[model samples]
Target chain A: MRALCWNGVNDLRVETVADPAILNPKDVILKVRLSTTCGSDLHLIDGLIPTMREGDVLGHEFMGEIVDVGREVTKVKRGDRVVVPSFIACGQCWYCQHDLYSLCDTSHPKPELQEPLLGYPTAGIYAYSHAFGGYAGSHAEYVRVPFADTDCFVVPDGLADEDALFISDAAPTGFMGADFCNIQRGDLVAVWGCGGVGLMAQQGAMILGAERVIAIDQYPERLAKAEAFGAIPLDFTKVDVIDALKELTGGRGPDACIDAVGMEAAGTGLQHAYDRVKQALYMETDRGTALRQAMLAVRKGGTLSILGVYGLMDKFPLGLLMNKGVTVRTAQQHGQAYVPRLLEHALRGELTPAALATHRFSLEDSPTGYHMFKHKEDGCVRAVFAP
Target chain B: MNPVQSDNAIKAAARASVTIGRPADELRTLWLDPGTQSRIWTHFAEVNPLDGRTAEWLARGPAGGEYRWRSEAVEVGPDEIRWSSLDGADVPNTGQLIFRPAPGDRGTELHLEVRFDPPGGVIGEAVSKLFHIVPGEIVRHALYKFRALALTGEIPTTDPQPAARKGGADR
Candidate 1:
C-alpha cells in the first residue's frame, strides 16, 4: 500500500508500506476514496506541534469504501461507502453520551502521554501525534477505523464522494462552531479567515439564520469564495477590520465572532512579526492576529466562538474579554455530533463543500499536493488525494 | 509516618483502579477464569492453571527478559481474590484484586495491588530494574486492558500497524 508519510519537518514522501488490518473486533478497513489536506496538517509538517514521529502517515479528513469489517461490527458492513470523522469515538463513554464525542474516554489507547498536558486525555484522533493515540491515518490505500458501527456514517445515495469528504472534518467543524453561537433571529456573525473551515463557518451562520455574515481575510480567492456564498467580504490587508466591522454594523459589533485561523495564522505588521520571530524560536506556538481581531470586533456580551486550535498565547486580551462579559466556546471538532445533520444538509443541496477541493492528486503525488497546500500555491483551499 | 526506615527495608508496591460498566459479581465471574484473565492481559503475562489452587505464570520483564513463577491462590471471595508465590519462585510477589460496587450505578470499581521486594538490598533494586522485573508496569497494563475488555469487549491497540521507521527501506 502506498501512503504519504512525514519524514521530517517540511519533508514528505510517498512510500510503500504494509497495509493495515483489523486490530480490534469492532474495527473496519476502508479503501480510501478521497483524503484531503487540512490547514491543521501544516502544524505537523512544520514541526510546530512537535509530537509527530518520522514515517507517520499524515491525514485525517477522508471518505472511503469499507472493504473489511471485524467480527463484532454490526450496524456497518463491508462495501458501505462511509464518511468517517477525524476523531475516533467509542460512542459509549460518558462524554460521547453527552454529545462531546471528542472527549470519549475509552478510545485513546495511550492516555499517560497526554495526562500531564491536559490534566486528562481526550479521545484519540487519527494521525495527529502519539500523544493523540498514534492511530494510522487515512492517507493510504487502506486505513483501519475502530468501533466501526459508531464511527462510520454511511454516505447517502446520490451524495457524490467529493460532497461527503468535507463532512468528515471541515463542514461539521464549522457547523459546530456556528452552533456554539446560539444564533438568534436577525443576529449578525463575523467570521475571521476564509479558508475551508472559515468558508464553511460563513455558510453555517447563514443556514442558522444570521441576518448577515462578514468574512475577513487578506486572500482574494478565499474572500471571493466567501462572497460567492453571499457573505459580505472584508480584506484585512486593505481596511481597518475592527473599525470596518463597526461601521458595517452601525457602531455595534457583530453578535458573534468566529476565529477559524489557528496556530499558523498569517498576518502583517509588528505584532505578527513578533509572533513569527517568537514562533521560530519555539517561544510561543500560535500567531494571534485573527483571534485578537475577532475579540476586538465582537460586541459587548457577544459570543466568541473559536473554531481555531491554539496552544498558549502571550497577549490573549483576558482583561478586555472579562470586562465585556464575552462568552467563549472552543473545542476540537466533535464531528460525530454534527455529521448526521451535515450529511442531510449536503443531501438537500444546502451545502456545497466540494468547492473547497481546489486541487487534486494521486496518492503517489501527495507530497507535491501537500507542498502546494502548505504554501497556498495556485490559491488552493484544499488538496484532495485519490488513492 | 515514620521517616527513619532502613534502606531497602520497605517493599515496593503499585496500585491501580478502574471503573467498569458491569456488575461486580459479573466481573468476578470472568476474572476468576485463568484463561479469560490471561487473555485479557496477555501483554503482561500468561497464566496456566496447574491445578485447583496453583498456576504457572510466564511473564516478560520490562527490560525484555523472561521470568517464571508459580502462584498459589491463598484466599477467594465473591468480590475479592488474593494470591501469593509458592516456594522456590524466581520472582516472589503477592497480589490482590478487589471488586466493589461503584457509586450512582456506574458499575463495579476494580482495584489491583501488587507488592514485591528486590532480592539484594539497594544493589538488588538496580539489578531488578536492569533485569526488567517491573511489577508496577505489569499492574498498570493489565488493569487498563481489563477495563477495555470489560467495557468494549476488546482492548484498544495500535499494534502491527504501519509506521515508516526512520532509515527504513521504504523511506
Candidate 2:
C-alpha cells in the first residue's frame, strides 16, 4: 500500500509502504475510502514535530470501510463504513472512563504520565506520530486501528465518506472545542483562525446558539467563509482587532475567544520555520503569540478556550490574566465524545462540516494535497484523500 | 523603610514569576470570598459558573464556553485558598493560593500554581507542551475573578446584582 510518508523537516512524500493487517484480537483493518490533512499534520511536514521519523505515514483524520476485523472485534466488521478515532484506547482506564480516551493509560508504551500524545504506544492510526504510537496513517489504501470495538464508529449507510470523514477529527474537534467553551444562546463568541477547524468552530458556535460569532484571521478567503457562516469577520491585518471588537461589543470585548491558530500563526511575518522547529524540538516550549492575542481579546470575566495544538515548550503569561478576571478552558478533542452528536446534526443538515472539504486528491497525489493544504492554496480549508 | 516599597517588591516578584518559570506563578497571593467561591464551584447562574460545561463551551469559542472551579478555604499556613478542577483529567489539577505579606505592608501578593500530569506519552508530552501555552492565560483570568470577589465581595453574575462588599451597591 502507498502511504503519505513524512520525509523529514519540511519534506513529505507519498511512497509505497507495507499494507497494514489486523493486529490485536481487537484490531480492524480498514480499506481507506477517505482521509484528510489536519493542521497539526503540517507540524510533521514542517518538522516542528521533530519527534516523527522519516517514512512516518502522516494522517489522523479519516473514514473508511473495514476490510477485515480481528476475532474479538464486534462493533464493526468487514464491509462496514466507519469513522476511525485518531487514537486507539484501552476501554479500561481512568482517563477513558471520563471520555478522555486520548489519555488512556493502555494507549502508550512505558506509560509516561506527563506528556500528552494519542493512540496506542506501538501502533496508532496511519502516519501521525511515532512517540504517540507510530501507526501508519489512513492516507493510504489500508490502515489498522486498534481497540476497534470502541475506536471505530459505524457510519450510517446514507452518509458519504466526504461528509462523514471529519467525524474522525476536525468535526469532532470543532464540536469538542465549542463544548469546552460552554457558549450559550445569545452569547457573543469570537473564534481566531479561519482555517478548516476554525470554520467548523464558527459553525459549531452557531449551532450552540451564539448570537454574535466573530472570526478573526489574516486570510481574506477564510474571512469570506466566516462571513458566509453569519459571523462578523475580523481581518487582523486591516484593523486594530481589540479596538474593533470593543466597539462591536459596546466596550466589552467578546464573551469568549478560541485560539485555533495555535503556534503556526502569521502576524508580522511567518516566524522563520527553522527557528520555530528548533524551539519546538529543543526548548520544550511554544511561542504562543496567538494564544496571547486570544487572552487579551476575551472580555474580563469571560472565557478563553484553546484547541490549537501547542506542541512546544513556552512561557505562559499569568499576571496580565490576573487583572482580567478571565477563565481559560482547553483540551485535545476527545473525538469519541462528540462524533455521534455531530453526526446526527450532519444527518439532519443542521450542520455541514463537510463544506470545509475544499479540495480532494487520490492516495497517489497526497503530497500535492498536503502542499495545497499547508500553503492554503486555492481557498483550501481541507484536503481529502480517496483510495 | 517605607511600607509601600516592600509591598511593591512582592508585587514585582509575582509579576516577574508570571514570565520566567512555573514556580513563581505557583505561589499564592490573595484571598477569595465565599460567594465568588460558590459561583466558580457550584454554578450560581453567574457570568461563568466555572463548571466542566463552561470549559467545553469555551473550547467551541468565547461565545460558547463556560467554566466553574471547586474551591475551599484551606488551613494550610503557606497556602490560604485552595481550588481544584471540578472536571478532573488523568492527573488531578489543583491550584494553590499563596499570600506574600511584605514587612509593614498590609496588602499581600497573589500566586496560583496549576499542575496536571501530561496526557499520552512522549507524544503526549510534546502535545502537552503545546497546550501549556494557554493554561497560563486561563489561570490569569481566574485570578481576575478572584480579585473581583475580593474587592466587591461578589461573584460577577450574568445578571446584574448587588455587591456584597458595598451592602447593596449596584453597577
lDDT of each model, Cα atoms only? Answer: 0.82, 0.63
TM-score for every candidate vs. truth? Answer: 0.88, 0.65
Worst 10 residues of 1 chain B by lDDT: B2-11
Give one digit per residue, the lDDT tens place, for model 1 in A1-387.
Answer: 888988897889888777888889999999999999998788777665555788898899999999999999999998999999999998876677779988877887776566556766788999987778888888999999999988999999999999999999999889888999999998999999889899999889988999999999888999999999999999988999999999999999999999998754321112433455474754243347778888888999999999877765666889889998999999888999999889998898888899899999999999899889988899999999999
lDDT of 2 by residue, B10-105 (tens): 322211111111122232322332334434322111333334222211112233433333333333565355555444443334556566553332
lDDT of 1 by residue, B98-131 (tens): 9888898678888998766445542335434744
Worst 10 residues of 2 chain B by lDDT: B13-22
Cα deviation of A146, candidate 2, in Å: 0.7
**Quality of candidate 1's docking, in CAPRI categories?**
acceptable
Question: Residue A186 deviation, candidate 1, in Å?
Answer: 2.4
Give me candidate 1's TM-score against the actual structure.
0.88
In model 1, the clashing pairs are none
Query: Which model scores highest in DockQ?
Result: 1
What C-alpha lDDT, on a 0 to 100 scale, does residue B71 get in candidate 1? 89
